[model samples]
Target: MPPKPSKPMMCNRKALPVAAKLKLIRKLEKGTSVAKLCEEYGVAQYCVNATASKSGKGLPRKHMKTARETGLDAAVLKWYVQERSVGINVHGVEIMSAANRLVHM
Candidate 1:
């Protein structure tokens, strides 16, 4: 039988960073054992699979998405990120306004 994780090992955490996930996946591709990787990285098997799946996406994954988050306009999110990269600090209200324009449905 698999050993039970300790109580401390069950502590809740934010989603692990993509870079860290990618690194773990890279190690796996290079022949590292999953059990050893999980132990070394303080993650579970679920995390390993999720990380691998998310690594190949064209978009970044958003963690803990709320029920109220359904109305997002992707173009606004993309433009917001691009503008931010060029040093623009956009507010939520601004994104909403822009989202309205981009969301034709």
Candidate 2:
């Protein structure tokens, strides 16, 4: 028997830009059917429907959080740069030690 075709994979977070997502959102808000959108955009119905439902919650695919998102990590990075600029003998151990201290406090 011939093999059945597999469904396309769900979009990865990076697959669609914010602008594209917003456009889809706008179309959904304007009463376009999710099935129509799914067919047009080649995306799953859930992607269009979820964005349609979360009009106020937040952007659906915010970039993943990173160290900068945590205030402590940003502060530590700034401190590391400043110390190096002053010719202080900063080492990896010292940086990690400081980070551990700040995290514990």
Candidate 3:
């Protein structure tokens, strides 16, 4: 008997560029069918649907830091500047230890 056909391997698809996503959204708005767009663009139906739903918003921007994190960043920057001004060779490990101490105090 002939061997059974093997299933194809699946791989992750690359994310579409903002321009491509915008084009897809425009086409969708112009009454293009989802299935037709999928075939034309070589993308999954979900990609088209998501792009249409989001209306070109794409991914959200990075979230804002909390007050504590903002304060920590400022304190670290100040300490780093001061260390450099005083001619002290500061390493990443030392910076991390300083942050730990600041957090504990």
Candidate 4:
């Protein structure tokens, strides 16, 4: 018997960016239909509804941490910029080494 070909899978999951969410909210305010918006954005109707309901709230910064961590982040960023400006190819291991050196200083 010959092998059968498998059917293609269709996945509809999507994560909309903040700007796109804001655009969807605006369109909703302008009386655009949810079905139409869903079709246009390739998102589910529930996503559009959720975006409309959560329009004005600010998105939290996932990378942000305490003051000490922020200071470390700034120091590492400065080191990275300096290294790059001097024609150095900064790799991940080198970055980690610089961060560790900065931490102990």
Candidate 5:
């Protein structure tokens, strides 16, 4: 098994930038899975969503016109679509809003 994450690793705030977070959320809106993002960056679900919420925008991978969109990679996008088509539903707005609320607490 992998080593347990240290406190710092568990609490990193530099996973992504404000603009990048916005891009990530928007990418998610186009059927991306939050779990993929969490695993990809070793970030908690709340972190991914809260960052996006603070940016006031969701990053839609489909809307991406270049290869520089951080964290919303092609493999992750494919997994996102596959997971979405398999009946797994992740309510984006509600999830993000709740994450935001929890972050502010």
Candidate 6:
């Protein structure tokens, strides 16, 4: 019988350098979105925020608005509610029925 293979090792690395963290903070301050920052930095927002948070730092304040507050079209919302519903076989009919009701409302 072949010898058993050892389990792979797991390692968690430390966060980025202070300078890099500051640079990201500056970019965030300039109105960059957290999602965009995460994509550009090749790191998760949680990681970035965790590092920043450790330094008692915060992302820039921006006037944020939700879709509904920004005048989302009723028809568009209705369509979205319809199209974005769960598609499980068990819930297919229920989802469609709910969507239809919203569309008509």
Q: Highest lDDT, which number? A: 4
Candidate 4 segments exceeding 4 Å error: 1-12, 56-105
Separately for all candidates shown, the number of backbone clashes (residues 3 or more apart, or on different chains) is 0, 0, 0, 0, 9, 0
**C-alpha lDDT values of all predictions:** 0.72, 0.75, 0.79, 0.80, 0.65, 0.65
Model 4: per-residue Cα lDDT over 3-105, one tens digit each? 8998554256789888888888888888889999988888877777767756643243245556667788899999999989999999999998998998999
Off by over 4 Å in 5: 1-11, 56-105
Which candidate wins on TM-score?
A: 3
Candidate 5, poorest ten consecutive residues by summed lDDT? 55-64
Q: After TM-score superposition, what is the CA distance of residue 65 in candidate 1 from its true location, in Å?
A: 27
- How do these models rank on TM-score, best leading? 3, 4, 1, 2, 6, 5
Please, what are the lDDT tens digits per residue for candidate 1 over residues 2-98? 9988655543553677788777889877888778887778878666666766666323455675644445645677889898999988998988788
Candidate 6 per-residue lDDT, tens place, 1-105, comes to 999998554234446777888888888778888888776666776777776666667654445765543333565555556566754333566555665675576
Backbone clashes in model 5, listed as residue pairs: 23-59, 25-58, 25-59, 26-58, 26-59, 26-60, 27-59, 27-60, 27-61
All candidates: CA RMSD (Å):
10.7, 7.7, 6.3, 10.0, 22.5, 14.1
Question: In model 6, how large is the Cα lDDT of residue 52?
Answer: 60
Tell me each candidate's TM-score: 0.40, 0.39, 0.50, 0.42, 0.36, 0.38
lDDT of 4: 0.80
Deviation from truth (RMSD, Å), model 1: 10.7
Itemize residue pairs with steric clashes in candidate 4: none
Worst 10-residue lDDT window, candidate 1:
57-66
